[model samples]
Target: MRHKQVAYVLLRITIGVVFLFYGIGKFTMGRAVLVDGLVQQFAKTPLPPGLVRAFGNVIPFAEVILGFCVLFGVFTTMALALMGILLIALTFGMVLVPNPSIVANNLIYCVIVFLLLYLAEYNTFSLERLWKK
Candidate 1:
């Protein structure tokens, strides 16, 4: 494989593992705890409790599913797009809470996902590539 393809694969797998562990950690810690923590964290913010709760509930599942998709390069473009959307939502929530650090970190993730999407042509070592042949 070319250097660019190798680099892209490394980045994709690294981000995927990060997200996979993040989601798994949330589940292991209990989703209810995460929901409660989110509700408490956003209590003083302008965000609605119901929305926070719902997002908290869905985030873990989304992370795990998208993480696997990105890791395996299955529908890589779509997975990256969805990951971008998810990061946007997380960033919005952090912004509402005035958590600058997390917002900054999330923005970095957003940029990475954007790059992955934009350079998707280099994704030659993925399951999607194999399936096409």
Candidate 2:
């Protein structure tokens, strides 16, 4: 494979695996832990109690689905876009955390996701490509 193919595969797989593990970690760590983490954020925001709870519940499963989609390179563009949006939201929330490095890392991830979207046409090792051909 050429450099483009290798780059595409590497980015896709890395994004997928990172999210997949994060999603699974929610389950392994238990729901109360996740909810408590979200609770702290909720206290800082104007969001209603019910909506915050719902969001906390929805996030893990959503990450799993998004991860699967990216891993298979099916709807890669959409997956990258969604991931970008998520990173943006996470970056905003990182302000509540004490770790500055994680915020910086999230910013870097956001940039990488955007770059992949900008090069979406060159992602030749994708299920999208196979379907088109």
Candidate 3:
């Protein structure tokens, strides 16, 4: 039982780190660059440029906030749900762009988020759990 909890915690932290760093990297690269890159990538797709830009504008902040929440086990389930939603949106866009590689990778992320959601009840080591006690 303890090992299962530990495994869940490790997976949560690992996913959090990946999202946190990816978001940080985007900011480091400059928001305009990131948004522009996204715009260009989805340019030929049916997705509207404005919609893509709006999503891009929020992606970094959402990733950072959600990543922190998951990392520290604060509202872990809710954070994971939001993460799943984000991944779904990303996957949708990738499919429109027909980028098989990224869509595949995003699907993997979706699986991880789903696993995290399932293990949320075992999140006894989280800050929220500790605080509740």
The candidate that wins on TM-score is: 1
Mark the 10 consecutive residues where model 1 has the least summed lDDT.
14-23
Span of 10 residues, lowest total lDDT, candidate 2:
90-99
lDDT of 1 by residue, 1-133 (tens): 9999999999999888888889989999999999999999999998889999999999999999999999999888988999999999999989988899999999989988998988888999999999999
Q: Model 3, which residues run further than 4 Å from truth?
A: none
The model with the greater lDDT, 1 or 3, is 1
Per-residue lDDT for 74 in model 3? Answer: 93
Each prediction's TM-score against the native? 0.98, 0.85, 0.97
How far off is residue 52 in model 3, in Å? 0.8
The lDDT, on a scale of 0 to 1, for candidate 3 is 0.92
**Candidate 1 has what TM-score?**
0.98
Ranking by lDDT: 1, 3, 2
**Global CA lDDT computed for model 1:** 0.93
Give candidate 1 regions above 4 Å deviation.
none
Overall local distance difference test of candidate 2: 0.79
Per-residue CA lDDT of model 3 for 7-115, tens digit only, reads 9989999999999889998999999999999999999998899999999999999999999999999988889999999999999998998999999999999999999
Better of 2 and 3 by lDDT: 3
